[model samples]
Target: MSTTTPETKTVLVIGATGKQGRAFIRSLLFPSANSTPSSPTTTTYPKSENWHILAVTRDASAPPARALLEEAKSHNAASKVTLVEASLNTPSTLRAVFESHPNIYSVFVVLAYPGLGAPVTSQREKEQGTMIADLAVEFGVKLFVYSSTIPIGPDANDGIDESRKQKREVEHYIEDLGKKNPNWKWIVIRPGFFYENLEGVFGAIGTTMYRDGLKRDTTIAMVASEDLGRVVAGLLQNPEPYINKFLCVTSGPVTMREVLNAHVRATGKPMPAVPGFVGWILLKINKGAKDLVKEAEINHANRISGKLPTFEEEVERAKSVCELQTYEQWKRALVSGEAGGDGELARRGSTDGKRMSTSSWNNLSLMKLLAGRS
Candidate 1:
């Protein structure tokens, strides 16, 4: 299954400073991040003899990036790899990253899409995605992994429109680039909606829509980010046979009620009501919200499943490294009498693009990855 050699392969990891990106790099850079790192050459920090990771960040000089460099250096792994500056906004910066590294073997795009509401974000992603794919082809990089979301389109009955439009646009853009650039292998990972989204929503409602009041029957697919990262990492070593194909991945299916139950376990609190009918009627007043509400209504109390992993199975993958618990784990964190047992609630502490230190979050991983495990 191993496509490359153990002699040494360089992984140019973009988004190396963010949540999923850091999770992946830290997994590669730190042996402690793994449940076991007894590899022969890496009795110290992981050696380049196996796999070296070139962690790239927008601000290579930033504190997080510096911390990473220092960590790699302290562990003696710095000599095995380098940290370069790159940005999607600036292709020149990204081009320099490729030019400086002749041995660049792969590209992992982990940043989020710009538009949560605007179509422009998706449009820009289509542009940047193709650009990255093209660069990989030009530089002779062996493989490129572009993280994506499940094609969670609007209701099957709603007909082809915006949801389907953006998903297809982004998917096709990278894929088309791969088609033209025969040298570069493309892996499009269509990850299901993240369970991470639930923690915050649950935190807000006091009671999850799953609390039997709101989205009782609404079904959604969820996966832990760590799981997605691991699968991508492992696949980089052994890719699926299908190229330019989209994967519908999820931990498992569960009702909003079930999620709420899990959240209450951690918070020891009831899920809140998602505004009553009046709230929905008010929300429906917005034209933009009309489709969203209709989509929600269609999924209400409906069952959905995927060929992807189950919730328990997905968590198991992220297990031993981090507490990849279902909502229920939230209960345990809360009940463990572990003070400051906040989960996604941390996302709420943002202001002007800044919040609490990310170090705290990374350090809190369930299966701790340490400095020299690999």
Candidate 2:
């Protein structure tokens, strides 16, 4: 008889109290109710049995962090997940935290630019991200999974925005580190627009604008925040196949028309279009609004020009790794109100409140920005 013990792996998750971080933690600790179509009967990925999550947060006593602690306690297998208060903005704090967990096997990093209560610039984002990557290399972490954004276009250097440019630079830095230290493995997950963005009060504005664009069948690629987490968890579970690779995570290539129809089906109410005069005025006056409009125009053109992959192709590629929810599935969860009563929604409001301030000017700015993007 041959006897062998499963090796235990510890994972450090940056921004662990945030939406994507929490989703990744949940997927790692629990069995996913939705499995990949290719393997419907596989309820859980194999690695969950031996992985321990070290979740990082700024305030361990905060409501969201406390809620995460409760969630960890609720599950028998997830009890090993621990929350540590630390700030990525402060390198000394990060260094202390990393030193405490000397044997961290993997690190999941999500750079939240313009982070809560601390509005950061693109240059700051690059510095923070590279700092963490350097620490990961120093600690000899085996796998480093970075949540990044897709390139603006087919050509890497073509018309990239400041935010996207910073992300691209960080990707290069991590890849370069991997090259220098062949022992370290890196994977980048570039996510599209999040479906969760169309939840709560902001959702109404998004749906309204989509109604306006329905006539032209304007579409945007999107993924559920939870689905992105699932993809990351799956990657962590089976990192060997994905080392040195990039995965563009998206759930739906849904058109505005389809989204409008879905809203009608869910609420039995018709969505109204935004007035052209209002859109034109906002686009002319608001810099944020102008940028969003340009992004939407570029995204639409890329979809039409075949620079981006079709919905089916993205779905297939995403499913090749883990199970994902369709737009309908996500909408049904929203309509049923099952997804609303959770910490994820609360976390979204808390984090977004910083960016989408309650002040009238900022609210109006956010509205205009959503109008352009949707």
Candidate 3:
């Protein structure tokens, strides 16, 4: 864990509705509001005057997002977090949010604006990257914790995955921010795929797959959302000397078989069998194959060695962290589609059973996962 002087500071976080932002927000406000505001000279607008937080969001009125804001306010965090319009297409919209507050100590850019038109490009990245850094510089905010992703290179034998492709532009610009400026605290956290995306499998709902009684295989390297939240919280709470650096955080990775067994232990069920075409057929009979095909490819990659976690350990930890029922305590929970509720559990949100939020799945602040100092 990194270290930062403890004090009440204002924070400006972009993409607050997404998983990463939500985690970041919850973590910041959850335990306490010990945040620092940015300096005056470094940011586009001075954010060192007072403690005023602004959250950038695409649609402030969306139910789930609105619910989050309502929760924040209910928690007496009305003075801590506020939702403001920040669209990916318009960089100024985002800039306006951070600039809106002259007292922001830290600015967590959760998403980048679509530069020009391409999915990933330095034009958009550099512009916003520079703007974010400039705001930090102008505001005197010592920390500029932008969320980033891992460039799927060497460690990622997966042939420069899609995320890497999108990251090309962001990586260069942010690296430039680190090199050229070198003063503001800039870091990235490049994490692996999240575990929350795994609950919607055919087996979870009870449709078995049988190809000559030989089940298909599903592999995965998944990260826990709370872990993601925790590290972000920990780093922000204590960014010691790691500021202005990039590092990775993961509990470790494992396979579907391992994961299912743990889930079974929690739910008191038989080990889930990985299904084949029959499962796909069952899916087609019920939901559809578009998702199944993608799952198959993901499973294939996991089986081949994707960055997943040790299923057994994750389940054990989840039992404690997620308050999962012991086998006897889980039957009804599983059937009712309500395994975890309250107690830091992932909330039920849109995007089908995605335990985490949207920003994570669609790639929010991959930088925070990739290069966070404190």
Candidate 4:
């Protein structure tokens, strides 16, 4: 048996209390200590013991942050993970974090979208992301990994969501930084729709939009955020081949009806579909809902016309790094309680562990949309 080296390198993770952060830390700290590479010619990736995670959060006392620490302890990696409080919106605190940890080997950033239940502008999102990238460069970090969203169309501003544009801008900034700084590198992992998006208040809204607004045959690209974490950790272990590459990550494409059926099989309860007219009204009135639905429609059309890449090749590339879980597999795990409840689901106010809240509407916009009154 080969003995792996002790953990020496440090990786600072931003947004450490969120789904992507938790998953990335978990995958990085406990990625099957004895697994071998699938390809004979491929490099044998580094073991979990070779890296330490410095998980950055805004509050160390919050439930999610506490949960992260407990989860690490459960895996017997408590010593390997440390939680540090730092607000991403405040540059001074973030700079202090980097100044305190001068030996940070790499950075993994996943900024919150629709930040903290408050409406977020594209410029605000861009500033937060670019600030982090600039700090990483100043700190002389070796590898910087950013979790971004998949492209909706061929052009930069084609996507309806402003967040997509911000992500693209950050990607471009990282690429430029890498060109100027020869000592370090960067990688962007652009993930498609997260499985968690179908599990809470957002889930209900998303499912309604999917069932009523999208065409029957349209297949949306999807991936579990957990799989994205493992893929990032695995890539960092062998970062040479994928340097400065924008990897499109997806498990596969499946129709909305297919996803609904899978949810039924998992929970033994059918996902309720809103009336077509209600969905249409929501799409007409709510810019967020309308843009999201329109983006999916555009992606579907571009895919059929071959104007947009399907990302089949990118999926294959991701598979080379980590084993990806299909939607069916993830649904089974979620229902079986093998996988923890999605952090986003809980954050979005999932009252009873089912899809959405049964109580009064805390998010009025979503409620209005559901009622066709938005």
Candidate 5:
């Protein structure tokens, strides 16, 4: 295991126990971090050269936190990882994290959704995101990386979701902070649709709905959590070229048919999807699902009609920073247990192991949302 000397730079990762945070930690600590530079022009860097991670979580001793520590230990990175008990809702503790770690060179901010034990409001989400950005400036951190959601492409801004609007406000705040402080530097990465959204019971519902409901041949932009981490690590390693930039971190686009076909190719079994009528009924009856359907419909229409801008340029940029995997590549890795966090799918025929449990299901306000209760 590596030791944190005075020269070692630290990084404070918010939402450290969640999928996105875990992916970032793995990219920082794991020896075989997933990064495939797609072109000869893309630049690449070695993994976890001389870095320490302050893995921030609400509970330092929780199973997921413990699992992260254990994974790092197995990779000879135990000394490089530290579990920090903190919450974004509590600004004092968040400040304490920066105050305590003077050598922290970068901060990775990925705020939680559905609030902390409350419904997710745009105001609450924006408050939490901007608070962290403000804290980073106050602490004089060199780089601030915020993982944001997808942008509303080629459309009137007001047509987007409220939560999305709040995130954009946070991005604006970061940019404003940079302009006001000449010495400040930051990068905003807006990851496309998540592949993990196709993993468990919720995935079952969502995948089935999309597959059966959306028009055939309509493609959607997607990214793997593993790849998102690599992209962040690259920017952290080399922040000069991308200062104040927004990277669309994605593995290009894939259609619903292609997504299902990839699953069959990897596992030799068809994906579990509900019938068309059932999916249509759920979309009509469930408010949350209905909203999801509405969003998908807009995206699908844009994609099919050539109104959706291509993500080809974004994928190429990501390659220059880190190696990226296509959806098929990720699916193959997932089946062979080669991909990071592939166990849930490999062992159980379902992904999102952490989210499949009864307690986990109940804890997520998002899960309640899928059930039309939130």
Candidate 6:
């Protein structure tokens, strides 16, 4: 096992290349850091601190991982970040990581979902999550922060979705670990739908809004990934009150119409809208498509249930830890093409283009299976 000084705090981040993982890494590297200036600064950074990140990825040579390393190097923070190659499915690799880094102060875990070349089953998610928690317990880690989705309903079995069920189970496993070891600190962050989902930036599932008709004036609870990052960073810095607490986080309950309007205003082009009939037909024919619709409906219900934290409340809490952007602020960045550049938009648009043709054929096959149309 590697040795560490008392001033050093090591954090292990799982799924470091994905959206949530990248957000956590950004927060750790530069708390409340942003790509653009003129963004309000709400949190202060220590000039010299002893926080280290063990960023885990299946491929350390991938573009995203390399880009992260490059960015850290540019900022002169290279020594603080380490890119380690490992997969959650392989217990031996994970064991090696834990063994090599005996001074892991905390772990930020975001369980994998199906997409982006990653075949993650609900069973695999539970097993991997539990394995990590078990290791943390065995190592006597100080804190564990888990990023999870908001439960669809109050009851454990309220939703019929297997993924939701798996999340709850993993949460229970972590909570049980904390209970068994009173010294271990655990925090669960249940974030709402990500803004990137609506922007078609996320792979595979980004087409859901278009498939669901993108109805105008319909509101959904959403949070910017960066904002969520800020919240996590804040919690890490001031973890006393958040110990064993579950935070339901959201940035805005913005309307779909507003999102479309923002695009039109930004790009000077009207957004495309799929017909409701077409969407319904697709949903009936494709199980995956139908699940997407069901997930949206469940989230809409949860938003109106008045059980979640308000945008203002969440913003205030996040501000206490780091600066965050509102929906309008994030939308403006997209519109102005100031976030990542045209390359980002082009990539998302390309995914949307492929989704249209592939999803149609998939839906048609299911339709034939059901209607005997073949």
Task: Find the candidate with the highest lDDT and give its number.
Answer: 4
Clashing pairs in 4: none
- lDDT agreement with native, every candidate: 0.52, 0.67, 0.48, 0.73, 0.71, 0.65
Q: Please identify which of the two predictions, 5 or 6, would achieve the higher lDDT against the true structure.
A: 5
Tens-digit lDDT track of model 3 for 178-258: 676666676566554554544333223222422222234543334544445545655555565457655444444444455
What would the per-residue lDDT of candidate 2 be over residues 252-277, giving only the tens digit for each residue?
56676676677577557664445656
Tens-digit per-residue lDDT, 129-237, candidate 1: 6677778888998878777654433332232234445445656777777778766687766565454444332223222222333355666655555445555655555
Predicted model with the maximum TM-score: 5
How do the predictions measure up, each by TM-score? 0.67, 0.81, 0.61, 0.84, 0.86, 0.78
lDDT of 5 by residue, 168-239 (tens): 788888989999998989988888777766766656667877887777866677887777877887788787
lDDT of 6 at 177: 85
Model 3 misplaced stretches (Cα beyond 4 Å): 1-7, 32-52, 112-140, 155-161, 201-220, 270-275, 278-374
Q: What's each prediction's clash count?
A: 30, 0, 71, 0, 5, 0
Sequence-dependent TM-score of model 6:
0.78
Per-residue lDDT, model 5, residue 147, is 84
Given candidate 5, what's the lDDT at residue 326? 67
Can you give the lDDT of residue 13 in candidate 4? 93
The runs of at least 3 residues in candidate 1 whose Cα sits more than 4 Å from the true structure, single-residue gaps closed, are 1-5, 31-49, 67-81, 119-122, 154-167, 181-183, 200-215, 240-244, 265-268, 271-325, 329-374
The order of the candidates by TM-score, greatest first, is 5, 4, 2, 6, 1, 3
Q: Report the lDDT of model 3 for residue 26.
A: 64
- Tell me which of candidates 2 and 5 scores higher on lDDT: 5
